[model samples]
Target: MFAGCIDIGGTFTDLILYERGKGLEIMKSPTTPGEFERGFMDVLALAAKSRGLSLGDFLVKLELLVHGTTVSTNALVEGKVAAAGLLCNAGHPDILTLREAPRKRAFLTKIDYPEPYIPRKFTCEVRGRIDAMGNEIEPLVEADVVAAAKHLKTCNVAAVAVSLLWSIVNPKHELRVREILQEELPGIPVTLSHELNPVPREYRRTISTAINASLYPIVGAYVSKLDQALRAAGYKNELLIANCVGGMMPPDEIIARPIYSVMSGPTLAPIAAMQLTTDPNVIVVDMGGTTFDVSALRDRQLVITPEATFGMDMLGIPKIDVRSVGAGGGSIAWVDAGGLIKVGPQSAAAKPGPACYGKGGTEATVTDANVVLGIIDPDYFLGGQMKLDRAKAETAVERFAKKVRLGTVEAAYAIYTTSNHNMIGAVEDITVNEGIDPRDSYLVSGGGATACHIGEMAQILGIKRFMIPRFAAGLSAYGGLISDVRWEEAATLHETHVDFAVERTNALIDRLRARGRAFLDRAGFPRARQRFEYAYQGRYLYQSWDIEVPFTLPGDRLTEADVPRLAAAFHQMHERIYTIKDENDVVEFTTWKVRAVGDTGGADRRGVDLPKQQGAPSPKSRRKVYLGPKQGFLEIPVYQGDGLGSGARIDGPAIIEEPTTTILLLRGQSAVTDAHRNYLVELAG
Candidate 1:
């Protein structure tokens, strides 16, 4: 079986061909910013062309195609999403306008807060009254709904979202609202908050639905177009898209709930590490051109956060917890107005890319610094397909060196170390701040730039073991191949144990599970190959956020025996996460989440078979490279990656150069390639 995967990154689109018997092969192509789908196809074509096969002929043997992209995230950041309309309660229609008041600048008179995506003019009201208990105090007036729909259509809204207060308790009014909008707007996408995220907080649910509505048309059209193109190209299976929670789902499911994939690209790095290594404690660092994405794999599970804020809009969805920093090869290096050197939260991004890319970028970036420091080979970058202009890089660094009053090499080293510490700080925020001991975890370097920085970052964080996969540059695409097809359905029925309705809760659980199973069945999963897992999203009394508690099935009802044990588990979990557990406090169940997973059989390859040999690998060449100010510049030996076969050992300071990435081992650190071509770096004991 063949599984094809593509990860559409900011600078490059990575393609992975996972041939069942032949292992995995990765290829990359520059991402076309305007028409992202073109870049997606371009990478796939390169992968096939390299193997002397046409795209159609290549895809015919594939079992599935999985893709991860930053399209939705880029759209939101650039304010390019389609116009949206919101329908809310008649008495209070300013849900989008009356946002929570948190100043753009704390304790300062800054009025730079952005306007809501949906203007007040585009927001209208409907006559409906559902109390907090989900009871219909006043019936939904059809006349008012029709008037709202007419107003939205007149405004030329691309999508309409309906979020009735307390809809989670009973979705009757919200469902009817969608029905009316469908009849009135025809093909226009409509989003219902209860169907998306049915939690207690009205603000998050409303915005989440509104955001979903805005993205539906854009994301849906992109997926549909890609699906059609793939089908025509001879791909016989469904095109699966990675989701917000670090799993693959049918693109149709993503279209229905676009909010579930808000930061889909960043989530895949950690998942890729999860699939490659069996270690329960690992940090996956994807250092691409524009950003450094850091995520942790703990206890064999992807750590997820319930609430994440994006551009002033708080999302109430469970998503992979990945911390991102503006620290990458393309992160611009500049002297701030305060006369201090800063790396970035701003980047040169992909287009003109880094100064060394020789694509007309004049700005000094981390990539330019690497070129100046001789950490990268200008002639060997991108397998020499695109040559790096060493003079351009030198000129870019010299400009910054003038500002800092330092030598060219000194300034370049400054940029490199500055960016390295910035990434270290970011990793600390996710691990140290969360009570995770950095020393207990290993680092798995990913992305095109990841291997370049992994050695230093791991050393600074006190991480002992570090490994970079041979196919690290396209790790996300490889992960997509090994992932399972998953579907999740959640419904809110907020009630404490005091008011717990066992039969009603069990019925709700079964309903969500059925929906999940039905979705899997439609996707062609056999009943035997499918299994349903359950969880309870809960929070303590008066708490704003909730935590997931694994649901253990106990017959069809909540027995008296289950309550204390469940409560104890919640207490233990809270203690572990928050460091505070109150056994006496009232614990409430907010939502019932049912997950359906279809097993797609996959096997991690055994280390490559190399003729058993001993002794260290030979260096292809020698070059002068600048370490930090402490070590200064030193002459180091560089080895071609392909020449160093499996079980090859090379001690520091040595440079292992691959077409896509380079691994730098400092003094005393030794790198040993395993049978699978994985570089496992060991620290000096």
Candidate 2:
């Protein structure tokens, strides 16, 4: 049987078809913003046609159809979410506006502070009170709830969110309010914090509920349209969507809880990098049109962080620890008033695209720089399917040069160098700043723009080894195809180390695992293929911050012997994260968690070996290139990437050109292709 996976990104929509016991087929098409489903279906049709099969014939043998999309993230960035109304306890209608003090920064002078998603006019209050100890100080009056519902109906909001204080301890008030809203406003969506995120922080819970309500209408409509299109195309297999936690979930679940997918598009590529190679510790860098995402992996497992901030909320959700920066191929380039060159936090987007694409884009971009520097061949880009205009690129770059008092080629090359430095700095922020040594990690680079700068980044980070997969451009879609079904379950426990009981801790673990298992089982995973993990939120007795420590349970229970071992593990983790451990202080467990995963075994594709080469060919051509203070452009050799073979060595200055990407080897560097056809570049002293 065959399985299909699709990833819709900001610039391109990628598709992959995996046939068991055979191999994989891939295709790519520009993403259509007006109709994303149209682009998705078009790629599927192209993949079928490439294999000489009909859509119906291919669907008959398909076992699964997995997908990853950026709809939720884009909606939030563009301020295009649904009109939402918020219902809160009386006298606390302004809780969202009274955000914590730590969020405001005084140095930012470019833009004003962002406003809350829910406007003041839409915020309604009801008379109800709950104490921190889960005691009801005042009963939830039915009349108050009815009046709020009537007010929301008159506003004609697309969705409603209800957040009550201490809902995690006792959800009685939130539950009662949801029932009344549903009864009064039939067919309108209602979200409750108790159902979405049952936690202690009032502001965080309120923000998460409001975000869910804001995204409900948009995400629901997108998923519904895609589902109908897939069904009409004769696809009768299970549909799974990639979530921000680097796992797959049923489409129905994603439609109801889209808050889990805010970072879905970037998480998949890292998982694919881990699956493609045998490296235990590595950094995965995925650079797309609008941004670059860098994530670190240790022992082939994605780093999970519980304190991820999403859309103005400190959501305590388990997500892959990814750091994203506003730097990419299509990022705009310009000179500030101080004569300093700047690359973007803004993009030309796919509508006009980069100036080199000759699509009416007036702003200069990194892609245009590569074209002006002779690093990219205008006629050979995308196999000549899309032609670039080198003259237009030079003209755009010269405009910036006149303002900065540098040559056109020099200014363009500076933009390229600065952008690479920015990306390298992002990697350091996540690793070196966090006390991890960069030399110990291998670099995995993917996406259309990453291959262009990987060799330079590797040199700067002092890492010698790098790997680029066979279908590096479509790794995210491939990741969606191979992801396992998973979910996270968590609960808060207020017990201190001195008062903690071994039996109570074990019971909480058991309850969480049972809940996770039931969720996976309902998704069609059998008991034999299921796996469970146990973890705890630990901290010093008086400390406010907590760290997550993972351990395997002994037959669904924690024995007395497990306490000391767990404490030691927590100390080691604390030392790694904070660079110190306070063994004299009492350690306490604040929250318990369980993550259940189901394996979907599939055969791995064998990699193709590179051809043997006796000697490197002479330079096909020479072009002027800049290398830091080496002043004027230096002569560089150019070679086609497909012609290089195993053991083929090339010395800098050189450029490797491929149909989809280009690689530039700077001065004082050497490159060699490995058995799997991946380039490993080393900088010479």
> Considering every candidate listed, which one attains the maximal lDDT?
1
Question: What's the TM for model 2?
Answer: 0.92
Write down the lDDT of every candidate, Cα atoms only: 0.82, 0.79
lDDT of 1 at 18: 76
Per-candidate TM-scores read 0.95, 0.92
Which candidate wins on TM-score?
1
* After superposition, candidate 1 runs with Cα above 4 Å error: 97-111, 495-501, 554-559, 603-613
The residue-by-residue lDDT of candidate 2 on 1-685, one tens digit each, is 7787888876778777787655676677778886898888888887777768897777767788888888988887777889999999989988777655334346756655557668878898888788888899999887988988888888889999999888877889999898898899988899998778765667767877888888888888998999898889898878888888888888888888888877887788888887767788888888877788888887676787766665444544557888888788888887778877888878876768888878798788888887887777888776566788998899888887888888898888887887888789889978997899888988888777787777778887888777765466677777777778878777777665556688877777788889999989988899998988777888888786778788778778877877777788888879978999987778888778888887765325434566786687556677766655555567788877767778888877788766566677766777778775566666655
- For residues 564-604, write the lDDT of model 1, one tens digit per residue: 77678788778878888988898898888888888766445
Residue-level error in angstroms, candidate 2, position 364: 0.9
Please give the lDDT score at residue 670 for candidate 1: 84
